[model samples]
Target: MKLETTHASADVASEVVFEAKGLKKEYDDGRVHALRGVNFRITQGEFVVILGPSGCGKTTLLQMLGALAEPSAGILHYRGKSLADLADPASYRAREIGIIFQAFHLLPTFTAVENVQMPMFETDRPAAERTERAVELLKLVALGHRLDHFPSKLSGGEKQRVAIARSLANGPTVLLADEPTGNLDSENSKKILELIIRLRREQNMTLVLVTHDLNIARMATRTIEMKDGLIVADQQVPQTAA
Candidate 1:
């Protein structure tokens, strides 16, 4: 089954999904600045790739976009509302945003289907419905046959596929993936990238991915290059005719 598109007001649908103004992040008692006054906006249904070298703040910016961490300074808006002002940030994350990390992050004991069903536990859906949806998602990721396999029994690529399916469990409008291909081999990386691109096209989801691979960055609709905690360049990828 195909995933459903996110519902939104016309005004909200037309607006940018994420807007960051002078965004900054500091640590080590303000001794280290991870993100320095970065400003960017991600429009709805766009696939944006954040590209930078190590320690250049690409992951930090991704964290901010995913609501995994709060910015030390500057303003961040999600659909025209300040992220800090949200009444329930956890609920916002659970319902509106999905995050996938470099690590697979699957529970070792749970089967692939169980792992995918974990996200639905936060909602009020019945258990049977959740299992059905999880099964369907695993099939979408080409893991239908591995439903009963634990993480240890699966290959690295298969684990990542499970993670991807889990990320979509909530039908989020925005998907934030940070170095999703980092741990995969070249072949596996290509497969994962293609899967992500297909999902974005099929679901009309807004994708924000962080990667150091230029080839991976080239596949995005927009590429944002960062260096020394600042945005160095932002360019649109030229479209190839179908």
Candidate 2:
């Protein structure tokens, strides 16, 4: 699909934040195909919900977008640059992409502040700067009071809040979330979704969220539905959907 996009940045000068051409991922010696050559383009400033049932390859697609895994076939691009060509994929991830996993992947031994500071270490900022940024981000996520608390000491909602703070540690432009509210109760899920929407607008970040919940998908400006590893639907959401 050719999604014509107007350039959005003065640096990369591209509106297309991500483009997947014939993207594929296979496992178990090609016996299982997680993704079957799906293609799509995400533009800047878009709130995109990737909706599908479990095992529909939504998470696999998100992983490729985050550079957390490689595609078994085809290519993925960020701002028109191939992900495979990145000199340091870790550096790219830390600087350009923010990721929220389904599991709140917080370090049990590290405090919330310390966990938030982990991504900034990839940057050249001084310790004091990293500390300041972490504090700022935690406060942004309403977790400032829990800065000194470890993952084991926090509630599920609190821990996920810490994870959200950690994801924004390095100020990435692209935010890839894989079912962030899956572990939370209804109230917490609402809170988390509100926080995420507010953050995306405040930061003007490109958000590609993966979820099966139609309630969540309704709030998005766009939704891409996947089935058995192929994109079945991609459409602009109606104003009333939100």
Q: Which candidate has the highest lDDT of all? A: 1
What lDDT, from 0 to 1, does candidate 2 have?
0.86
Task: List, residue by residue over 152-174, the lDDT tens digit for candidate 2.
Answer: 99988888888888888777778
lDDT of 1 by residue, 1-242 (tens): 66854555343455688999999999998999999999888988888999999999999888888777899999999988999788888888878888888998999999999999998888988999999999999999999999999999999999999999999998988889989999999999999989988987777788899999999877888999999999999999976510
- TM-score (C-alpha) between model 2 and the true structure: 0.93
Query: In model 1, which range of ten residues has the least summed lDDT?
Result: 4-13
True lDDT of residue 18, candidate 2: 93
TM-score for all models, in order of appearance: 0.96, 0.93
Candidate 2 Cα errors over 4 Å, as ranges: 1-14, 239-242
